[model samples]
Target: MRKNSSTTFVFIVLFLFAALIFVFRMQLVGISGMITNFSRPLQAGLFSVFNHPSNETNKKFQQVVDTLVSQAQMNQLKSDNNALRDQFATANIEPSQLLPSRIIGLPQFLPGISLPEQLILDQGTNQGVQKGMPVIIKNVLIGEITKVESATSLVTLISSPNFLFTAQTQNTNTLGIVKGEGADKVVLVNVELSDTLKIGDIVVTKGDKNLTGKGLPPGLVVGKISAINKSPSALYQSAAIQNPIDITKVSEVFIMLK
Candidate 1:
């Protein structure tokens, strides 16, 4: 009986070994495709688990680099501005006396008839800005402060139809009234026909001799004459003057206190 039991166990072990050999042969005969198909999802899962965090880390490092570059540029601008202020002091022109301000508000056109003809500044009476104060950018006259509140002011652009200033031509020293003609254009009217009023003549502010020193500084560029309209019958010649300032691009300005 013991011998019979031992024989049955040997037969069972031999049958299992034969089944394992058959499976190995099937894998060698192109049935390995099934094994590969079973492993595809596991391979993708391992890739996602390991690579996703690395990609996120790379993106975060790029953002940090961008922020550092922007900060460096801002620091450079501040340094250059300080140097400019010191240079102005050397010229005996008290730049410290001038109030530097930035444009804060721009014209926002709505669906209706509302249009903004002026700019809003961040400085106002609280910052020593007053009405009628000349607003300039880099020594060029662009406009004047028309209204001053406690913390803000309104600037009437030189392109406004109601704005006017006394201007003189550089070559001829001929005086004329520079008046805004709307649409970023000005006209030098009342120029005598005999004067050397020609196209391309540069115009500048003609200072006044009033007691309160209310006049704009002389030599502040107004614009250059682009066209000259001369008529034999008319007593005075009018010329179209091009506005030097592109108001849309203005970001910073200064108000002359003295």
Candidate 2:
């Protein structure tokens, strides 16, 4: 009877060992799938902490984009506001007298020279923008319209080497032709050597008319004289004129009707 009991105990131990082996094999085959089912509620939380597209990361990226956009918008608003103020202050001119237009395009290089000379406007013949009309930005003369289309027009910037306009000194009241020297520099020519054009003297349009009878009005600020070059051997004195406004930064302009 004792021998029989020992044999039964050995069988029982063998059966338990076999069961343990089976359980281990099942876990090895489907361990990953079992864990996913068990932790489904926490899966999203784990991914957000470890992945690149987390909520925190998205918020940070959005903030950076918003800052950049806000800065750009603020700059544009300032420019527009300044333009409106200039229109109101200029010669007490009514808004109906001035035609507002945006620069649609700018040339890569000026014609006949490698400089920024030309720009295109959104106005055309339909808007009464004719060739040779003066283009001003904030009461300052920038260029003249050279070409006209049905819906667009081309402008020649005063800084171009090919551009020339009649200007006069404010303090001395001297008349001279302002000629572009490339690189945003201009030279006042044909002034008498004895004329007193001092540094910091303001220059403005002379309102001289062309054969077409259209001309820029007097008292429109052009630039300021920065240097004077007088030669005893030369017939007239010349000076370097500094433009007040940066042409590259200009976006909108006014086409004077008169």
Candidate 3:
């Protein structure tokens, strides 16, 4: 009776093992698709419940990014518009609308050290630029067109040693020749000691009397009087001008060809 009981238990165990293997193989081969079909709705429902807040959070983050980008673009547009307005205000000729360009190279003239701070315009005669054209950066006088080419030109900076301009004192109404010193300094030549020229006086071009224009336009603000020195012989008084335009920052300019 004990042997019969043992045989019956072994048969039951063998049958259970065979059934387990069959179920596993069926799942691997064909039942996998069935299991996915049955579980998809459950998975989707669980995701909706758990991920709804996360999706909203992601949308908020994206909105923040979009706001930042829009602000940056608005700032850039405002800057560009301000620059354009300045160009229009300072420009002289209707056709000579102050166009923008990059400084590709430094001004090269024979026997002079060019100041890179003074801008060199990229467009030249090809862009209707001509000799005697007035070049200005941000409404300040820089230089005038000296050499013209099909695509390039040389601007004679007012700070050059040989540069000279006929400028009048804003306070004194006194006219003198403004000549560039070796450095960035300029001298008000032949000014009389009694002419009432003083330090901190503003200087501007005497357009009607100016000869060279010194790479500048008539009536443009040149600089202020920084210092006044007298001649030992009392023959003349020399004054130094403090230029307004920071040459180093000159990037783009407008050429006014009359």
Top candidate on lDDT is 2
In candidate 3, how many Å is residue 213 off? 12
Candidate 2 residue lDDT tens string, 37-137: 34433533443343334466555644643453344344435545776888753233234367898665655654324456777776777678788888886
lDDT for each residue of candidate 1 in 27-129, tens digit (9 for 90 to 100): 3423344444454456445433433334555556446434533443344355457768887432122233578886666453641234346777767665788
> Can you write out model 3's per-residue Cα lDDT over 135-191, one digit (the tens) per residue?
765444667778755555567777877777777776666788888775566678877
Clashing pairs in 1: none
Task: Assess every candidate by TM-score.
Answer: 0.59, 0.60, 0.55
Residue 14 error for model 3, in Å? 99
> lDDT of all the models against the reference?
0.68, 0.70, 0.61
lDDT of 1 at 14: 97
Q: Candidate 1: lDDT over CA atoms?
A: 0.68
Enumerate residue pairs that collide in model 3: 117-247, 143-215, 144-215
- lDDT for residue 217 in candidate 3, whole number 0-100: 48
Q: Ten consecutive residues with minimal summed lDDT in candidate 1?
A: 88-97
| Total backbone clashes of candidate 2, pairs 3 or more residues apart or in separate chains | 0
Model 3 misplaced regions, further than 4 Å? 1-97, 107-119, 209-217
Candidate 1 root-mean-square deviation in Å: 29.8
